[model samples]
Target: MKKDLIYSLPVLLATACSDDAEPQSNNIQCIHPGEDLQAYYDLLTQNPQVVAAMNLCERPASFQTLLWDKVREAEKTGLPPDAPKPQSYYDFGLEMETKSLSGVSFDSNQYQKIEMVENAEYDFYFPAKDGEGRKLIISNQVLERATETFLRNQEEREPIKTIYTTKEEAQEIYAAHLAHSLWIEKNEKVPWSIIDYNSEQLGELFGTRTWFKTWDEKNDEYVISLVLDHSPRETWKVINDIVDLEDLTDQKAGVRGSAGYRYSE
Candidate 1:
């Protein structure tokens, strides 16, 4: 059976903020600068990598470059001759008007681009209220929540394959997983320990817990016991009080696998 897997990673504070600066909390409201919304949408639609990276809600240097280039190109041709230039930074923000999930909503004028230090990597810039510069870097937690909300509304989701039966298939999943891990590390400055944990527990472990039903011919029937006979037998219901040993075993294996190195993470 085909399944859709979405892994959630923990959000970290951006590395660009100075030691003296306090990191923005998820509660802080960021006003979207009301930049070219259509253009920003176009940018994201055209670039799948950016979409995947946004799933992490942390922007890397390459993602920054892409945004800058998109805005630059727009300035060269799309903007009017008399349009005022952005003070010091590009006026790009996502106005996810009328879209929301959980307790999070992207009301108009309430979302801003995640800010980063100029020419710096894995860092964010949050200008003081009395100071002059870009004022907000969308909090990582807020961004992650927003991304989840936005992805749900999107018609076509980026479906990442989780369970593989062959080395070739496993390699593809590994490559994608590795790429995502590297992107998170580079942009969010997340440690490998956390990444590996999420990968194993949320990924392989969850897959194993649900794997039996996925391949079972009588998938809808209640699993009474594991039969060794090759022939199809009568299905029987199991006691509700029975402990899910399979789930426990999968968790143990996932924890064990995470303790050691894997092809990815």
Candidate 2:
């Protein structure tokens, strides 16, 4: 009964929220990880629960304090049993990459106050498709952990070594790689008779990924990078490897991967 209840909870919650209620009309958004770190950081600074979540019952440290006290953890000391992991305090990227790409869950109105920044001055920098800006949908758990380290800065009053992605720079980065990239459009519909996307094809497996990572720099130490999330590769794959719908049912099923990135400060 417990197992059944647990299994049915996700479906129940999803069903309760969707089918009838218009998700789009309700100002409900799926915020992607790292979409607006600064804004989220501000929220973290103000929210006591979020601050306590990060502090984990220890002396509050700077945001740069990446990892947690593992030795203390082993000794069952310092942090309480429920503290978040260090990597958890940064980004959902590693989990997204490692976790099986089966479900496409997204963060909704739970963290709704994550303020977005847009201006006419940067109008020229906007991408051709969405002239306004971009939006990402992250999970609640991911958002909770991701903000801990960032919010620490507020408690410690640490200097913000923020690297704003400039319009010209953003435009330049977009043009250099993704401007002509194949994953910009939606893929053909997936067939219903599919099996598994990670089936072994000798050494290389088959799957659907709409995101990629690209390093950017002016040949210097200070380099700003962006992780083209799942939306970017909607059109195709890394090599634009679009499988035939008929072929999908045979061996290579659908393993859909989303895009995310690491914003180093």
By lDDT, who's the top model here?
Answer: 1
Clashes of each: 2, 13
Local accuracy of candidate 2 as per-residue lDDT tens digits, 1-265: 2111111112323333333223433322211113222233233233323223222112112111211122122123321112222232123223433321111122342323332122112111111122234455444454444445334533377432222343333333232222122111112234431122121320121111111122233332222323323222233333234344455552234443212112211
Candidate 1 regions exceeding 4 Å error are 1-166, 189-265
The CA lDDT at 178 in model 1 is: 32
How many angstroms is residue 47 displaced in model 2 relative to the true structure, after the best TM-score fit? Answer: 35
lDDT of 1 by residue, 90-198 (tens): 1112123422222222333444333332222222222222334446445556555645545555335632122212322222222233333333333332223323343
Candidate 1 scores a C-alpha RMSD against the true structure in Å of 27.5
Clashing pairs in 1: 16-123, 16-124
Score every model by TM-score.
Answer: 0.15, 0.17
Task: Give me the runs in candidate 2 sitting further than 4 Å from their true place.
Answer: 1-15, 18-188, 193-226, 230-242, 250-252, 256-265
